[model samples]
Target: MIKLQNVEKVYRTSSIETLALNNINLDVKKKEFISIMGPSGCGKSTLLNIMGLLDAPSKGQIEIDGSKVENYNDKDLAHLRNQKLGFIFQSFHLINDLSVIDNVEIPLLYRSSTAKQRRDLAQEALEKVGLSNRMKHFPKQLSGGQKQRVAIARAIVGKPEIILADEPTGNLDSVMGNEILGILQKLNEDGATIVMVTHDDAMAKKTHRLVRLFDGTQVM
Candidate 1:
C-alpha cells in the first residue's frame, strides 16, 4: 500500500548537484514482496529510504496507505513510520550491551504501551524469528545468523504493515542468508508487505517481483 509518483532525489553542494533518483514512479500493493536491485550508487537504497520515510524526495509525491506524506512534518512522519513501518538492515543494528529481548523492546518504548505489554510483544516477535530461547543473551554471544534473527525480531516487534529491508542478508553466509529469506517469505505470506534492496541476484529472484535500477533510473 505504498505509491511514489514522479519522485526524484537530489543532493546538492555549493559546487555540484547530484541526482540520486530520477522520475521514480512505483506502486507496492499490500502483502507484495518486491526486490530492488542495482549496482552501487544506482539509488536502490535512496528509493527505499524515501519509501520508508527515512528520507524525503527533493521533488514529487509519496503516499502511504492512500495518505499523502509529502507534506508531513518530521514529527508526523516519525509517528507514521513508527506505526506503519519496520526496518531490517544488513548490519544488524543492535545495541552491543542490550540483551536480545531488550533490543526488541526498544521500538515499543516510543509507543503508549506498558512495560509488560512491550515485554510480551517482544517475546512474541522473538518467537516468530525462532529466538525465544535466546532472549536473555547479549548480541556478542550470538552467531551471525542469530544476530540477524534478533534484528528481524526487533523489526516485527512493532507489528508494522510494511517491512523495508536493506540488504538483510548481505552480512550473512549463504546458508544463513537463505534462512533469513525463508523468514521473510513467511512474513510476506502472513500479510506483511516487504520491499527489499539487495545486490544478490539469487536473493532478488526469491521475491514476487524484481525491479532493477541503473544510473538512478528504473531500467526494468
Candidate 2:
C-alpha cells in the first residue's frame, strides 16, 4: 500500500511560483484500483510522479509500505522505483529500434538477471497483454493499441506491486480503449494495485474509487 500525508508540490522559478498539488492526503489500499480525474493543468500527473517517487514533494511526506521516503537516499529511491513500482505513461515510451519483446525487456536491464530470464519474463508479460504473436514486430509496425499493450507489458515485466499509469487510454479509439481498460481491470483483479490518471468519466467510474482534483487541490 502507498500513503501520502499532507503532500504539497511547488515549482518555483526566479520570479514565478506554481502550486502543483495542495495538501493532498491519500491512502491506497492493497489491490485497490483508484482513478484520478482533473483538468489539463490540475496536477494529476504531478501527484502521480510524487507517488511513484520520481519527484520529491516540497512540503510533505511519502510513505511506501511502511518506510518514510524522506529517509531514503538516491540509491534507495532507485531500488524502490525499480523493484517496487511499475509505470505506464499515456504515450508509449517504447524504443522504435527494439523489437517488441526487447522493448518489454528494457526494465529488466536495470536488474541483475540473465538474458534467458529477461526473455522469459518478457515473453510472459507480452502474452498477458495478448501480444505474444507480435513479439518479433517493431513499434512502428504495430497499431496504437498494440503499442500501448507493449507499454503495459514493459511496465509489468518486473512484477512490481504498484502500477502507476498516466492517461493510459488517451491515445486510442473507444474499442481499443476498452480493451486496454479491461486489461488493467484484469490486472487489478489478479492483485496489482493501480492508480490511474484519466480525463474520461466512464473510465474513472470503473475503478473502485475516484479522486477528483481542481486547481491542484483534492476537491472530492
Candidate 3:
C-alpha cells in the first residue's frame, strides 16, 4: 500500500546539511505488519515521518496506494494523509487539556461527520483500545499506558488505511507494552496495515516483517 524509491531526506541549515535518510527503498503491502528497528539517530523515525506524509523526501518518490505523493499539492497531501494514514507516537501526543473522547474526536472534527457521528466513532475507537470507561478523563489523570491507548484511539477513529507507530511501547512497562502490542496485532489481523518503529528486538519480531536501518540506510 506504500512504496518508497530511492528516498533521500536532507535537513539543511545555513552552513550544514545533515542526511536523515539515504536512498530508502521499501514496499509495504496492504494489511502487512512491518517493524522497523534501528539504533538512535539511525533515521527510523525520519522514515516513518516521510512515509506518513508528515515530511517530504528530498530526492525520491513516495507512492501511497498508487498515487505519487511527491507531486501532490499541500491540500492534496493533507487530504490523503487524513484519509489514509494514522500515527501513534512515543510521547502519546495527547492534548492534556482535552478529555479522552475529545482527543479522539479531534481527527474526525476536520471531516464532514456530524457531532453525533463523530462521538459514536470516537467511542467505538476508545472501546477498541479498552478505554471506554476513561473517555471523560483527561490525559493527566491516566497512566502512561492508558494515555497511549487514548492516542491509539485517536489514531484509529478515522479508520485510516495505515498506522505508523514510532516507539509505541517506549514509555510503558513490559506488561503494558504487551497489552498495547496485542491491540496492534489484533488490528493487523483485522486488516489494518501497521508499520511500527521500535528499539526492542522482541517487539520487532512480533511483526510479520522486519527492516533494519543504519546510518539512514536500510541495512537488513
Question: On residues 1-220, what C-alpha lDDT tens digit does candidate 3 reach at each position?
Answer: 9999999999999999999899999999999999999889999999999999999899999999999887788899999999998999999999989999999999897799899999999999999999999989999999999999999999999999899999999999999999999999998998899999998899999999999999899998
Candidate 3: clashing pairs of residues? none
What TM value does model 2 have?
0.99
Better of 2 and 3 by lDDT: 2
Estimate the overall C-alpha local distance difference test score of candidate 1: 0.95
Worst 10 residues of 1 by lDDT: 65-74
What is candidate 1's lDDT per residue for 82-136, written digit by digit as tens? 9999999989999999999999999999999999999999999999999999999
TM-scores for all candidates: the values are: 0.98, 0.99, 0.99
Query: In model 2, how large is the Cα lDDT of residue 178?
Result: 93
Question: Model-by-model lDDT, in order?
Answer: 0.95, 0.95, 0.94
Query: In model 2, which regions exceed 4 Å deviation?
Result: none
